[model samples]
Target chain A: MKEKPVLRVTSKLLIPPIMLFALYVQFHGDFGPGGGFQAGVIFASAFILYALIFGVDVARRIVPAWVSRAGLSIGVLLYAGTGVAALFGGGNFLDYSVLAHDALHGQHLGINVIEFGVGTTVAAAMVTIFFTFASQSPHDPEDLRDEDDDADFDDDFDDDLDDLIASRTMSQGLSQAGGAGGREAR
Target chain B: MELAVVIGMLFFMAAIALAIIWVRNLFAVTMLMGIYSLTAAALYVALDAVDVAFTEAAVGAGISTVLMLATLSLTKAEEKPFRSIQHPVSLAVVLVTGGVLIYGTLDMPAYGDPDAPIHQHVAPRYVQDSGQEVGPPNIVTSILASYRGYDTMGEVTVIFTAAAGVLMLIGRGRSGPGRRRKTWDYEDLEGDER
Candidate 1:
């Protein structure tokens, strides 16, 4: 994976355009077929591509899992909050007509706000999900553990392919495997 | 000519579906499923469901394929052969569901009929007045975000709920934190290892 120069360069070039398209899809939903859900997925995918290229550790540092968890909650709050805002403005729950001075203006403003909330939640959730799945086994040991103990652990590795008992520690194996490549110098 | 093109595309989609069913390789199936969604997106375009086409192409064809490939990397590349006897219950369930679906279609009006219940009912009003009422150039947006605001909220909630469920199931923190300390600095890690 680290050896593919063509993929690395192409993906590096594609990430920004992908993110920009996601933004366009997010804001242009009102005038086109796109909306929060599609835009959110699109946005998350750009980061997913980045993670695939640069490895999960760098991606996690950029957009931590805790932030994503917060985003998931915040997006829901924003949508529900918009409804409450409309209600407090003398309309029923989610009645955007009363959200502003004029009904049309209120509708426009409310929809935009809610869509933003939707986009935020979706992008965060998708990215978090990808992180959780991708970071499950191979990448965690490298970043989350001490390299000293990791090296000591790897030194005890049995070269016998038939010894399944020696393969108990997946983290130990992955660290040795990845570090042995030595090409992914970031 | 348009009808011929549509028919050809439909045939291609059918072939892909049959291929998906026939192929034993999970990786090939994943690729076929991507093709399946792309074709579905094309069908949406043929039907002039541009918004749906966009979603079908982006989410259905693009993101889902990547996600599936990611999932595949976590597990075996080939599906195991069936170890259990085929169940009559599954066949019964499928037949019953198909029969019910076909029955439901009996009451559906002809495709694009002007006097269809859907066209005759609230849709005409939506088409005629949505521009003035919702004040958006896109009637679809007006209907989804304003006219059907509650429904859209519910859709967003569904995504949130699904993501929440998945996070709860497979999320981080299961590996027993506090078991190890972080050693992120490269120079410090090299010193420690030495």
Candidate 2:
């Protein structure tokens, strides 16, 4: 049996740090160069790497198709939901100041929520694409069968014609002998 | 020291951009483009446009690459051979654009000079009063979500629209279920005695 390539120890070790960096970017958007979108990609890339190494089937098993779909929808909804919340708070749509009586706190909460939504949607979409491509089976077996049948038909037809010709020649010889006997008696 | 670093970064960014344009393989070009976007984001950070950088890094490096790969998967990765001499025209246009941009930049403020008109503008008010008025530690967040809340809403809507477009373009739609039926039929046939 052929051995399958396993996920390397280095990749496994790298995942934790990448995940931590994603969190750092998510929470530390104010002070640092990173934020929700970059962080989200980095987060997704970790999983993508895993999928590349272990195969798409294993990755799909970890993050199922339906779940990724839900994640995509949920992320958009979560981002949109923040805006709706602002609308209900008696301000124009997405006015985070209205989210709390203290407008600054509202802004913080709103950005956080929307960032999370963006992250989720981006990650899920990436995984979903990988799944769809990787899951497709390569060969169509029916085409092979059709070709086999054509070959078999040609072989069978040739053999059957040969058998029929042999039988006909034998019967004709027997009939000729009988006729010869009858003529001799006369 | 910072100016030297910025110039070095710009050179790196230009190299990446050139590499992306020159790469023959679409997938390789996409990857290089992601690197180019990241480098651009880093430049944005040096310029203190953190929010824009963040968005660029995410959309450009992450979503754009995925979308490109998805598109590549649906089409042939290689460009079809063309007998046209369009390369010279493309190079001329690119060079002209680059010249104009460089000429425009020469008149702009030196990189990150504190007394630059940008630093003296209403941005100071936002940076200072955002904590007091909007109550967010991240002033950009405060401004984006509060003072310019309607714009953010519009942006989100745009994202939704793009996602919808992507779903329409790449989605399996009604054909997925039909494909499953074919697969199942094939399986059933395979199970029968040959």
Candidate 3:
């Protein structure tokens, strides 16, 4: 998948717009068919695409596992802290009315910030899931055994042949089927 | 026209389900699941639940398929052939549950019924007053964020907890080329006895 020039060029070109769309979905959620959950997933998907095209290590350097880990909590704290802030301002728990001078302004501020929190957590969760699942340490024999245990070995070797053909057909667009080096099959 | 599209989508969904069940190849199954999600999202759009459609498209179609593929890469792509016959007890349970669900649907109000139990609730107030009460023109956002801010906050917390759980279980935090993996390393080199 990484070898093809067309794929690399197009994916590099495509990454920004996808990210921009995700942002649009994040902020324009109130007015259109978009929201934090959707935006977050879209954002993660764009990163995943970048990882797919560029490399996991490259993408990791950009996003950083630590940053996402911080995001996981920071997003939640932001949302919860907003509520506590409102409560301290002489309103009930999560009551946005007292957060600002007026109710309308408070609602606007509250929704945007809370939605941002949701977006952050969701995006971080998604990327974390991808990183954990996709990047397996290849040299580990014990981890290999874990996979072997889960996978029931087919007695017939021809099944592998069939699987090969099936995979070839399935991975038509993804032309780098054979001789794929260092990277796992996505 | 809406009814026709709904019917078509449902048929496609049923066919996709059957194909998914029939396909022993996990990779093919994952692709079918993506198609299923896309179909479901389209159906949501037809129903005018654009927010739901968006979520379905992003979460179900986009993220879920990628996750499944990732899992498949980690594990095996071929499912073991079924050696056992269908269990009568399980079949009986499924039948009973399906029958009960269908029977329950009989007592349910028609779709888009204005006087439905849900519509009778404070949804009306949210719909009517959201524009004035909350500055947001989108009532759903107003209700989700402003009106039920605590619930939204809780939802964010749940997502955060999920991320934390994943991190605790399998997060490879700050792993470089030489860095050893974390708890989710899947590398039980010690072969610690269970």
Candidate 4:
């Protein structure tokens, strides 16, 4: 993935806008055509693109395993905690009307808070799943022995084909299929 | 006009599906699946489900494609050749199920029918007063975050659970002595591993 000036420059130009759009979707979801789930996925996708172009290791350093894990737990807690707060606010479980002095204001606050919680968890979950998959041992040689009879030939061909397809389709970020390079880069 | 657009999009989706089925390369299949998801997202827009469209575009087209590509790296790029495509029993079962599904829809209300049973339910209240009640102009957001808050919370929890499951299965953090070495010399690591 290294030594690709075009890809690196393109990613640098595009990533900020993508992140901004994700935030727009996250916040404007209240008045428009997006919400937590969409925004979260969008947010993670920018990082995924970054990972693909640079390397998985770089992406991991930016949003480490612990950070994503914290997001996963904290998001759920924020949501559930909101409900618990409502219980203490002299309302039933999950009720939002009593959170503020007025019902409408309370609803606004509750909805925004919960939506943020949802976004956080979703984004974290996606990043975690991707990182886990990305970081796995590329192959268990024994598993390939039976299924891929021409293992040596097929492996090389698959790597080239993967690179070809990735470059052609994505138009940037080459060399994801080289697990050897990926591991060594780490 | 909207109906025509929907039908055209549906045809595109069907074509993509067929292409996916015909393609043996896993990479092409993944790409086709992304296209199919994009078409579906467009269909959602035509049907006025913008939220769903956004979700489909981001999650279905974007995330799923990337994940599938990552998985492809871990496995084979080409699908194994199948022995036979003519499975009469399976075909019969699919035809029967699809027929039943279409038959079921025949009993439902027409598109945008105002007198539908759903329109008569609590939907009226949500549609009419949700702006004032929830304070969001987008009724979908209002319902999702306020009226149906529990369901959304459950969905968030489900996502969290999925993350937890993935973490337990594979995200054990960077462990093992080999990974910990972390030298910048690619050749050294390569030689050692080989």
Candidate 5:
């Protein structure tokens, strides 16, 4: 893929605009049709396109795994934290009107912050999933061997714990668990 | 004009579905599915559901198609030959389900009917007063981001969880302490071989 000059040039030309459009969708969502979810996916699509053309490894180096993992957590925290901020403002949970001196201003501010959070999480999640899938061997034999090794025992355990807690809260409860279970079986 | 576009896209989608059913090549089926999603996205735009259209275009036509292609690279390109296509029980089930669905649509309101039950519900308040309440001109955004913030947050979390699960299952450990090494990087092993 990296050897193709035409593809490299064309993708290089297209990627920037695709990314710009994604940002437009993310920020202008309040006045336009798109919001975080759409924006995030669009943003990920740009990276996916890059990966397709240049290579997944190259793209991963630019974004990296930990950066994606952090983005995932940060986005959720930003959204939930906004709600908590509302609570501290002497309003009910997720009530944005009390965030500022002016109700409309508070609503606007809260919506922007939350939408940003949503966009970040959605984009990171897509990238992480893509990287995970793309990185796997087509004929996987390491599944058994990898499970047995435990050198960074504390780090792996903590990472697994973080992912589990995040997933539990984020999941739609019963249905998501069932889907995750099915994936695990595979 | 919108009706004409909708009808054309519906026919196009049906043709794509029929082609998908007839195609034995799994690769072709995946491509046809992407086309189907693109058509559906266009149909959503014609129906004035731009938000939904945007999502379908990005997710259905873009990411999912790429994912399916990635999955295909890991599996056989040809679908397995079915032992038999005709089963009386399966046919009966399909016919019954389709009939039930069509019958259910018969009781629904016409497209964009102001008096529809859904329109009569809390939709009116959201449409009329959301400007004052949530302060966003886009009613959809206001409803999603403010009026129903919790649901959106939960949806985000669901996506987050799904990605985490995928990473846990198939993702190589990050290259650091306790890292599990790959037998070979796809680039190094498969690139030159191909």
Candidate 6:
């Protein structure tokens, strides 16, 4: 089977401008038609399109699954950390005004930090979802083999073989069949 | 100020809306929906709500359509062939709701009225003091991040929750590796013949 091409040269060409636009939105939210959340999603979507065109394995190599999970956790932590910092500063949760001794600049700094955090988490979560789905096995081999074997076997032996294959496949297919051994392998 | 532009925009919006309702193909409907969002964003710009227009453009034209397309991939393209008779009672309910909305709009201020209640209320505070209060050049950012910061936080939490839910529902569950192993075993059987 011909594998569908995921990232075309044209798509690669398209990503730069879109990413630049996302940056424009992120930094220029003070002036223009974009903000952190929107820019983050757009940025993530560009990668997502790349993954869709390319295989998930390639995408995973670019942004690995463990890294994506860490990205998500870090993004949330960065956001909540800012909030915690404010709390330590004797302000309410996420009170930007208290972030610095100079109240005015503190709010600006706080908003920027939080938005960045939100953007990161959103992007990472999106890629993670794509990876999770892409990683799922769409076919079962044992079932196929047993079906094939049944076709070759004689009627007398066929029923016995079928029952044995069915039970074995069932036990293997269910994840909890051998608890400790399976967990260790994983 | 031109009569032609206003008429054209209205006609375009109507045409797009009609297309959305009329298209039987889900893919076509999704494309039309993107067009509808873009046009609506344009309309928001024309109405001078640049901030709202920006958001509508990004969320509606960008993210929503991507999500819709992603969802479409997991399901069949066509609607099921079953048809239900249009009930008069349901039609009446829709008409009544629309009528009420129209009736409410009739009493409201005309488009872009400076003296409107909306302009006189919390908006003026946001416009005037946002730069001074929040120290951000953009009033929309200040409002979204500071004035209504709690709501923004809530929105983020909601998205996080949704992402978690999707991850849980679809991520590497217990059976996945076993399924892969079963496939590998079958492939081994095929290889044995060679």
Candidate with maximal TM-score: 4
Please give the TM-score that candidate 3 achieves against the real structure.
0.83
Residue range with the least summed lDDT across 10 consecutive positions in model 6 chain B: B181-190
Q: What is the lDDT of residue A105 in candidate 3?
A: 86
Q: What lDDT is reached at residue B67 by model 6?
A: 58
True contacts kept of each: 0.47, 0.28, 0.66, 0.77, 0.68, 0.35
Error of 2 at B87 (Å): 9.5
What fraction of native interface contacts does model 2 preserve?
Answer: 0.28
Error of 2 at A123 (Å): 2.9
Kindly list the per-residue Cα lDDT of model 3 for residues B27-105, writing each as its tens digit: 7798899999999999999998888888898888988887776666555657878787789999999999999999999
lDDT of 2 by residue, A1-186 (tens): 012223345557888898888888877865555555566677777776555444444555688757777877887788889889988999777777678767767777887787787677766766666545433332332333344433443354435543222222222221222233311221
lDDT of 6: 0.65
Off by over 4 Å in 5: A140-186, B174-181, B184-194
TM-score of chain B of each: 0.80, 0.74, 0.85, 0.86, 0.87, 0.77
**Model 4: DockQ against the native?**
0.53
DockQ, in order, for the candidates? 0.29, 0.12, 0.42, 0.53, 0.30, 0.19
Error of 5 at A163 (Å): 35
DockQ (0 to 1) for model 5: 0.30
Give the least accurate 10-residue stretch of model 1 chain A, judged by summed lDDT.
A162-171
Interface RMSD of 6: 8.9
| Candidate number with the higher DockQ (3 or 5) | 3
Task: Please give the ranking of all candidate structures by DockQ, highest first, separated by commas.
Answer: 4, 3, 5, 1, 6, 2
Which candidate would rank higher by DockQ, 4 or 5? 4
Candidate 4, fnat value? 0.77
Which pairs, if any, clash in model 6?
A6-A53, A6-A54, A141-B183
Model 1 chain B weakest lDDT span, ten residues long: B177-186
Ten residues in sequence with the least summed lDDT for candidate 3 chain A: A173-182
Query: How would you encode candidate 4's per-residue C-alpha lDDT over B144-184 as one tens digit per residue?
Result: 99889999999998999888887666555466443543323
